[model samples]
Target: MSFTQQLHQAAQNIWQKSLVHPFITELQSGQLPLTKFRFYLLQDRYYLVEFSKFHHLLAEQAGNPQIKKFLLQSEADLRACEWSVRSDFFTGLKITPMEIRQTAVAPTAYNYVNHMYLTLERDGFAPAIAAIVPCYWLYQEIGQKLAKVGSPVALYQTWIDTYDSDWYEVNVTHILQLINILASQATATDRQMMQTAFIRSSYYELQFWQMAYAKERW
Candidate 1:
């Protein structure tokens, strides 16, 4: 399969295994709670910062000029998310910056993202991109679903606000563009390696979310 096709397929697999099949049933029933929604928002806020940091490292290491630019743009996008979370916290919504920061660095998801970055920084850009794809694609898919589900449904609005924002969309587009460029530069063997890494990373992403949601158990 072409690189884009492979990426899409991997993403579809993740959605099927993680969000679409699992949450769609609950969401369709409109039975998910506000506390759970809040927990998701808080969890996401913590995660995005780590993502931004990882992209910053990638931007610095990127051999391809286009990929470099995309990484830089992604950093900006992450910052915008940070700002939005702060806004949400300051609005008297019971959200706090410390809580977000603490959760971001929590042992489970935080450590996983950190390990992915370390692997990428140590291994190569291809591996790093592979490690990162699940986070990007999964967030996009979830955001789209939440958007369909509408607001005040327990974390739906906060999620919509974060994931559907211009900053988030731009980052997603840039990552896809970077992947396309990377695929073009890679030989068949390298492309295969990237594909494997992408699949593994995507699975890890699902695991992280599942773990986080389970831990919160709202």
Candidate 2:
């Protein structure tokens, strides 16, 4: 199996739970409370900032020029998406930068980003890729599925369409390809570490949805 396929297999249960999580289901149905979504947006804005740092650090450590280029472009795309798309989400939801600044990071998001940072710090390239891909790949998968069924809410649909796009898919595919290449060269121990990182990140994805749905604090 391809490295990414194996990572998916290992984390399949977590991914399934994420897909069926109330936040996602309610989002697809457009019955999700805007209050809940507002909390999510606030937390997500924090996440995007940390995510850019993770991307830059990973790219800086990547020895391969192609991988570095892809990581940089992926970070750029994330910035563009946040500015052009999520800025409207912030405005329409009446979320202010001050509110985002004032809000403390929810435990789930705080721990989740820390997990990525720690993995990158300790394990460097291959493992860091495994740690981070779940965020992009899982969201793209969710977006693709939800896009077909679609949310009645325009804002939610816009969110879905943002992830379910050609550009996003191409980035994900490139990452998957890179993962396989890295895996082929990885030792057995290294491969196991990568798998563990992937699964842990996947579990965090499920927790994140639950946190937002419950408006988890502290």
Identify the candidate with maximal TM-score: 2
Q: What would the TM-score be for candidate 2 when compared with the true structure?
A: 0.97
> What root-mean-square deviation over C-alphas does model 2 reach?
1.0
- TM-score, model 1 to reference: 0.78
Top lDDT prediction, candidate number: 2
lDDT (10s digit) by residue, model 1, range 41-149 = 5665667657777788888888768778877876786676655665654454676657655653445556567667766756678867867876776777777776775
Q: After superposition, which runs of candidate 1 have C-alpha atoms over 4 Å from their true positions?
A: 21-30, 89-92, 97-107, 151-155, 165-167, 216-218
Clashes per candidate (backbone, < 3 Å): 2, 0
Residue-by-residue lDDT tens digits, candidate 2, 148-177: 899999999999998899988987898888
Shift of residue 170 alpha carbon in model 1, Å = 3.6
Lowest-lDDT window of 10 residues in candidate 1? 20-29
- lDDT against the true structure, per candidate, is 0.66, 0.90
